[model samples]
Each structure stands twice: as structure tokens, then as C-alpha cells.
Target: MTTTPGAADWRAANLANWDERVPIHTAGSFYDLPAFVAGRNTLRDFELSEVGDVAGKTLLHLQCHIGLDTLSWSRRGATVTGLDFSAVAVKAANGLAAQVDATTARFVTADVYDAVQALGGQRFDIVYTGFGALCWLGDIARWARTAAALVAEGGFLYLAEYHPVADLLGDDGATVENDYFHRDPIVVDAPGTYADASAPMAATVTVEWRHGIGDVVSALTAAGLRIEFLHEHDHSHFRLPAGKGIPQVYSLRAAKTA
Candidate 1:
């Protein structure tokens, strides 16, 4: 089914998909809530070095799946708010926060595009959303606008995402069988997630929009954010490489100068 560009169907369907995943994710070992409760920080070493000191900064994580990263920021002294479109995910995020005794962290339910407005124009010291975030968004321009709006002056956006190049490659990581760029959405009907290929899921279908790396940078720059640094890495936090090292992920740090 082709989703109309302006229609809410795509958003609603994606929301339902994520809501269904919350339970499976909670029961699975993917998020590692127990490890978090045991004082493990989910923040990757790369992000820690890039996002910089979150201490005393207001951090906002948009499209926050279950809030592990958000609570981690709170653990490091940043007052954090995690936002997602799925009510189930938001609830689970809250539960995770409480489990970790992160009293300062908060979670809210909202689409990524609507996040800034939902927060009542509240911008943050550090606006972060990446790592599988770009594909879910059909309009990179609009997404960039919301991201820029959420950045407090002098503050920036820390985006660590799976590289678009990997999106075109198959699981084997050797064949390029898909389009490298797409202006329309791709519908996927699948029973499992990247975390667990065998886990039973209620949300078996999802839609994604592909954006090239250049598209991402252009959108952000057009939205008035300066690209501080963009780095490509051979290691991916979520991927077990199918073969030799290739650029699997990229992280960008951008700040608003306008």
C-alpha cells in the first residue's frame, strides 16, 4: 500500500509497529536493563567522546526507543528527556529510568517531527537522535528543521548513525541489491528485529525512507546547523561484520550558528 505523502497513515502504522516491539524488547536481552541497573552506561565510547560533557546540560533524545541512552545521560549528570512515538516505548523508558534510579530523566510520547512542539518550544543543550533514525524519516529536510529547532544556542546535535552505504548492502555485507538513494518509502514485512531474529513480534511490518549521507549533511546545513565534524567508522555498535572491515557507521556533530 502506497502511503500518501501528507497522510497520517504512515506515522500511525510505524507507531503501532514500535508499540508491538516494546514487550519483546523488554523481555529480550538486547537492551540489557539489568546491566544498566548494575551501573553500566549504554552510551557508546564513541558518543561519550563526541557528545562531550552532558553534566549540567539539558539533553533531549528524539525517537528514543526505550531510553537506555537517555537515562545514561542522566546518570552522567545531564537532565534528560526521551521522546518516542510509541506509548508502550515511552512507558518502558520510564520504567527503565526508575529501575536505574535516574530521577532526573523523563520520557514522553511524540513523533520525532512533532517533538519540539510537544516539548512546548523547550530546546536543549544537546539534541541527539541517530543510530537507525535517518531511515525512518521520509523527509530529511523536515527532520533537520525539528532537530535544529531543538538545539539551544551554542549547543549542538550529536548524530551517530548506521551509514547509508550499509543500508544498500545485504546481510552478507557483500552484495548491493538495494537502491542507494530513495525518495519514496520502502515497505518491509518481517517478523523479527535486528536485535533478535527469532523473537516473536507483534509488529512485523515497517516502512522506511532512505537518505544518502550527502542528503543528510545538506539538509542539516540548509537548516542552519554547521557541520562541526563528520566521521565514518569501520565498527558498528549493532552490526557483526559479515567480512572484512568496511565503513559501517558514521557520527556527526553539528551546531547552530544562526
Candidate 2:
């Protein structure tokens, strides 16, 4: 329930905490299930146009929280599998899939780092990760390798994440605050959770890591995936800071070369 202070301990605690947050997220207003049910695409326009045709493709969505987007891909005719570190998320995802009659989508519970091992030798046509996902990862290079390894030759990896530039600006509601470069693991002692702002959370300390633009690109390239395109935009899914204005999504594409 509570995270310890050390790095290794923090990871486990974070994973456990995320597991608890999944159900809360599923019922939260932020996800807007009614809108999703009304055929709205939760994905950004840049992400949709970049990944393009998923019809008949096998897609893997990593770090899928409750699989709204994963099921959305399945609706577009992609055989989709969603993976998350939280058992609760997987359970919630599976429930939503059955409810929405998205029989083609499956959910798996496993840490991103151990996904390859936990998922056997499954490969996919598209490897997708999205906003707010990378910040939780401590190792960018390893994450990239894991993503690349899961893609079949000619398949590609797509990510639409919060711009690292935006992250440099702290959430202080005023001026730019934090450093852009990857810093020592961020440790926060808080009494509440991000998913359920109103719920009373046990005073728990959590840790997070920051990965810069270069770190993201170089890591993917080093994993033997060729860069297709990288597009940065001007509107994020959520409001970020004041002067930095609203954050935009960065769409990155990396292809596995033969």
C-alpha cells in the first residue's frame, strides 16, 4: 500500500499503487467513458494520422492504463493487446472490452520491463505507448529495447507523449521550475493520488524519473529501430503550466529494419 524510499523498493510500490489506481481511473471523469462509447477517439489527431491504417494489423499497446485506447484500436479492425503493470488495470480493461463487445482486444498484466518474458514470444505490427507513460519508467534505453523487440520486421513503434520541454517547467502555476535533463529520481511525499484527487490516500512517498528528447530518440535508434518521423505539436491532453502554455503531443515513429 505504501512505497519505500529506495529505488528498487519504489518501483514495486509504484506498481502496486498503480494497480490500485486502475479501477478508480476506470470510473473517473477524466477518461469520459460516455464520450468514448459515442465513437470518440481518445487518441490525438497527430497520433491517429501517423500510425495510420491498423486494419488487419496486430497491435500492442504498452502501459495501457484501462485500455480505452487499446479497445479503440480494436474497433478500427486491429487485433489489439493491451499490457499494463497493474493487475487491476488489466482486469478493468478486460471488463470494459467485454462490455464494449471488443472481443478482439486482450489485456495482460506485467511490468513493461518484463513484458517480453511474461508475454512469451508475441510480436505485433505496431508497438504503441502514449502520454504520461514514459515518465514512470526509470530506464529509457531498456524500455525502447523492449518495445523494439516486440515489433515484427516492417512493423513500427508509435508514441505520443508529453513533451519533455514542457516537463522542465514545474507545476508551480508560475514560472519554469524543473530541469530539462534527466535528474536524480524524483521523490514526492504526498497524501493523495493523481487519479483520485478527492480520495484520502495514505501519506505515501513516490519516485519518478525524467527522460529527455535525445534520450528517447537515441534509445530507440540503438534498439535497431529506424526513425521514420518525429512530430511535435502544441496541444496536450491536459493543461501543463502557465507561461509554457498548454503542452503539445510529440508523435514519434520508429520502424524495425530488416
Candidate number of the best lDDT:
1
Clashes of 2: 1
Tens-digit per-residue lDDT, 14-45, candidate 1: 87788888888888788776787899887778
How accurate locally, in lDDT, is each candidate? 0.84, 0.82
**Per-residue lDDT for 1-258 in model 2, tens only?**
233357678787677667666656767777877777767788766677889989999999999988988988898899999999888888888988887899788999888998898879899999999889998888899999999999999999999898877766555534667777645678776655665667555536567788888899999999999999988776743655324454546888999989
**Residue 132 local lDDT, model 2:** 90
Q: What TM-score, computed on C-alpha atoms, does each candidate reach?
A: 0.94, 0.91
List CA RMSD, all candidates: 1.8, 2.8
Residue 164, candidate 1: Cα error in Å is: 0.7
TM-score of 2: 0.91
> Model 1 compared with the native: what TM-score?
0.94
Worst 10 residues of 1 by lDDT: 236-245
Where is model 2 poorest over a 10-residue stretch in terms of lDDT? 236-245
